[model samples]
Target: MKLIVQIPCLNEARDIAGVIQAVPRQIEGVDRVEVLVVDDGSSDGTAAVAAEAGADHVVINKKTLGLARTFQKGIATALSLGADIIVNTDGDGQYAGHSIADLVAPIVRGEADIVVGDRKPGDNTDFSASKRTLQRVGSTVVKTLASIDVPDAVSGFRAYSREAAMRTTVFTRFSYTTETLIAAGNSGMVVASVPVDTNAVTRPSRLFNSVRSFVLRQMVTIVRSYIMYRPLRAFMVLGFGMILIGLFPMVRFVYFYFTDGGAGHVQSLVIGGALLVCGYITCLVALLSDVVATNRRLEEEIITILRRMEHDEAARD
Candidate 1:
């Protein structure tokens, strides 16, 4: 199978050359490797440097599209060029060249569709930086929001089988590592994390900015997907919770009204009316939410269709 290694870059002129040059060779039973460098509008000489370093494909995005779109373009281009599997890593020297073979094993062996490189900050012995204090916190919050259990959710190094790559076309345009895990799980692919080394970059790293933006995108994506994938489920949950809590007061007010004989208690009437109205409105909104959810799912399906066609044609070529 043809393998494409995508290195999404911003302004890393210093090590884009090194990254491309070090695209791991000689793993048993491996065939060809095509290294793709996505140059995300670097004002520096990153594109030139990657080309000079002999990258198989140098995809230069016209503008700075941020991290997610940068990676997506490379993925699309790689699929267009008939890549059977895609492995991605940072343009900085944080990821080791040797780790790629291990990353691809799960995909090649049919054990998983997406394999993530788990980067532990303890591996960063060189730099004074500790594990991102907010990284784990942000991940936990998003997990609660999205109902997923992914650790080390924002590391960039990963490998994807063709099936997984095709399914990711409908994802958030500005997503990164966090979003990828959720997207993979949403797409019904098994997502696994394997250990990898994270080291000081040859160039300064903007991964934290990339990580923060990615977390926001992931939250939005999960919320949107939550509604679309199961509008009925979302509605039932919110509506049911409110109904039960409101029921106690509602029943009490009704008994007081009937047994005590008609609008005899004006306060009870007002309170009951307000509670009922609020609960009904919530259920109504939940039902209407189904309509909105249908439209979103349709939009995602359209993107999926287009990308699927692109992927199939590329494989044909």
Candidate 2:
């Protein structure tokens, strides 16, 4: 089994070398280990630094793709290179490279399709109180949505089995951490998390400028992912609520109309009628959305099959 540890770097020249060197040269479960550096339009010569540090492969992106896209690209490149297992870590060396063995242990043992590294609380003492609280709250929300106990949902250090890698897809460009967990759960992949240590802060997070902004983007991503994965349930709840709300006013309007001879309740009748129409329309939209979601699942399955076939062909060559 070959393991490919990939790091997505954007102007990470300073820390890339140490990160690469810290990776284990020998592990019990794997036949070969290689490092892949994905340079995401880094003008700081990150690719050159990685190459000089003895990285096995370096994939360069001409334009700066966000972290999500860079991550996806690295996964694709790793797949093409016949990686049996893929481990992803930050290019800034925030995650302790030595802990990668523990991260991939579940995969090697066939216990999990994906394994996420859970950073212990206070691992990064530099994190603000609000940021820490948000991390906890966001992780709890992800656990609820994904139906899995992922304590560190935002941790970038993760490992994926070949099958899991092929089966996963990321829709949101904001971040892949939460979306991948949710997707894996929805797709019935075995997901697990292991406690791992992290290094000191090497640099500030480029993903978000402020806590409020991060929270806003994460909220959008979570809602979008929930809708994508469980459109029927989401729409059903929304449509049902709207129907109940519409019914309340309509019931009131009817009660008043019959009791008062429909004299001063014309506005109530109009408002109730409009709401009822909207409620029914919302239900109709739910059905359509469910159909589209089903099609999307089918498409993803097809893509997974194609990926496997391509990999098989490459192996034969």
Could you say which candidate leads in lDDT?
2
Candidate 1 ranges with C-alpha deviation above 4 Å: 121-134, 137-149, 170-173, 201-218, 255-275, 284-306
Per-residue lDDT over 1-317 for candidate 1, one digit per residue giving the tens place of the 0 to 100 score: 88899999988898788777777866544688889999999999899999888988888888988888888888888888888789998888788888888888888888888887866644445543434554566557546644556556666788988877877754555556665665566556787767776655555457445545645655676676556556777777777676666676667778877787645566655676676677677788888887877786677678778888977876787
Q: How well does model 1 score by local distance difference test?
A: 0.74
Q: How many residue pairs in model 2 have overlapping backbones?
A: 0
Candidate 2 lDDT, 172-287, residue by residue in tens:
88889988988888888889999998887857799899888999999999889999989888887887787787787688878887898777777777887777787788888889
> Least lDDT summed over 10 consecutive residues: which range in candidate 2?
120-129
**Each model's TM-score, in the order given?**
0.80, 0.97
